[model samples]
Target: MFIGVGVTIAAFYYYNNPVEGESCHIQKENNVAAFVMYGSYFYLFLQFFLARYFKVRVNADSDKKKKVA
Candidate 1:
């Protein structure tokens, strides 16, 4: 996804340039936030790969049973 790509770019940029000696490794909250962001992106990309190459459907975008009332 474009969002994930953008986040990845931002992550790389920040990692290369820390804020006044503060960083994900030194800040507890920053570490947690970084982990969560990267974890989510990794999971999404992995699922996409599996779906594309292995015919795995993690989540359906539409329900066939839906009806207009």
Candidate 2:
């Protein structure tokens, strides 16, 4: 997913900007790259949070069963 986002953003920039001119274009590309990277990282964090929540629920259920037994 991260690679896909990066490629899509890169292709958009490459098609819209000339490859042979202007250093500022590089800066714009860098900004886009940074955004994609951060967005991907944020997505991973959400996934981690969800997984942890589910894991805690499962452990609580197991502990409850052990206590009842």
Candidate 3:
């Protein structure tokens, strides 16, 4: 789904901004889109990291309690 959206957006960008002669650079908005996309991916990674961190902490506490008992 994400791949489709990315490809569709890229197609529209290239269609609107075709290379003429010398300049072949993407528009400023296109660069911003790239950053936004990466930001979303980073957010997902952060969520995964936090979930794992808490899970490990909970397991360690449980193990310590069992050993004390």
Computed on alpha carbons, the lDDT of every model, listed in order, comes to 0.67, 0.70, 0.69
Clashes by residue pair, model 2: none
* C-alpha lDDT of residue 32 in model 3: 67
Off by over 4 Å in 1: 1-25, 56-69
Best by lDDT: 2
RMSD of 3: 6.2
Instruction: Sort all candidates by lDDT, best to worst.
Output: 2, 3, 1
Candidate 2 global CA lDDT score: 0.70
The candidate with the higher TM-score, 1 or 3, is: 1
- TM-score for each candidate, following the candidate numbering: 0.44, 0.42, 0.42
Q: On residues 16-46, what C-alpha lDDT tens digit does candidate 1 reach at each position?
A: 6878958644444664576677779889889
Cα lDDT of model 2 by residue, 1-69, tens digit: 667667667766775775676443345666677777768887998899889875645457779899999
**Candidate 3 backbone overlaps, count:** 0
lDDT of 3 by residue, 1-69 (tens): 367457646755775677676554556676567657766886898899899775645457779999999
Alpha carbon RMSD to native, model 1: 9.1
Clashes of each: 0, 0, 0
User: What is every candidate's alpha-carbon RMSD to the true fold?
Assistant: 9.1, 6.0, 6.2
